[model samples]
Target: MTTTIRNGIMIAAMALALGACASKGAPTSQFDFGPLPAAAPASASSIGAIIVADVTGPAALDTERMHYRLLYSDARQSRPYAYNQWTSTPSQLLTQRIKASLAQAGVKVLSTTDAAASTTVLRMEVEDFAQNFDSATASSGVVRLRASVFRMHRLVDQKTFSRSVPAPSADAAGGARALADASDAVAADLLGWLAALPPSKE
Candidate 1:
């Protein structure tokens, strides 16, 4: 081929590559827990006016990215979706959900910033928060959190809550819905545990 023709073909390929990159750079779609379901009837609680501390999580989950893992291919590597993100960090989302769920159940949920005297405090740490795929077409949202209840600096009790809910679809939207469900399930379990506790001696 002539040198002129070869240069023209190379330039065309570069233009096409740049065009593809620009398309990929389009704005990403953001997500959150969406909305909590219709709450059940509120009931009286012995655990009254408790405080909820901010949730802490690994550095990976400290961002707004939507994370997922392909267990069938590479289980150790977690990847973020190219065109989707979370409206907030995973820890923040969980914090909001837990507080809302507790309030809906008739617990007097208070934030750490709120004034309280010798009130019960709940602290939580995120262990794992990601969508894992069993196969190319199947996945589940998984959440693992460790919670500690304290009163006047004394550890009252500690427990870990976890859930793995199957996604409706294999995409990011499905993952978000599944994670919201799993989070709600965990929050409900935490409520049960809290309710079973005897009134604090304080």
Candidate 2:
């Protein structure tokens, strides 16, 4: 009887200890791009249909981790912020954002699987996507992307777009805002670029 009682007490103690350990870890914060700006009405000049391919990037950016760099200290070393992360990979987020922007501009955004349905394809690759700290108290979010436009599998145009926005603070929250701002800026510029392209013969 005594042995059974002692075993029960030990089990209870172990449960409590495990519970404490599980709850002791810091809580992680998740973020997204937030609401996008209202898109203007589609005009007759807009591209008819397009397929925005899934964005591709370096292996480092393939995860949900939030990345940052201390340019003033060691520019080559990119670090992930603790207890802060994105809802998805940087590539996925940016791809969704670009598709939304294209649809808003009156372009019919199609899926890559619908290749036969569209002649124009837009492919983007991440060149830079991280918050960069220039000093102990100053930081900015920078995003760079190479955009390629293909018509009927033929490359028509390619360009690189970039935006850097000053962070309001030197923390995850600030980085999120700055990055979103930079992303929006780049999307706007891309929208204009798409509008200016020569009218497709198809």
- Candidate that would win on lDDT: 1
lDDT of candidate 1 over 33-96, digit per residue (tens): 8888876554537778788998998998788988788786579988777678889999999999
For model 2, the superposed segments whose C-alpha errors exceed 4 Å read 1-24, 40-44
CA lDDT of 165 in candidate 2?
99
> Which lDDT values do the candidates have, in the order given?
0.84, 0.83
Global CA lDDT of candidate 1, please?
0.84
Clashes (candidate 2): 0
How high is each candidate's TM-score?
Answer: 0.85, 0.85
What digit string (tens of lDDT, one per residue) describes model 2 on residues 121-179? 99999999999988655789999999999998899999999999999987777888899
For the record, the alpha-carbon RMSD of candidate 2 to the native fold, in angstroms, is 12.7
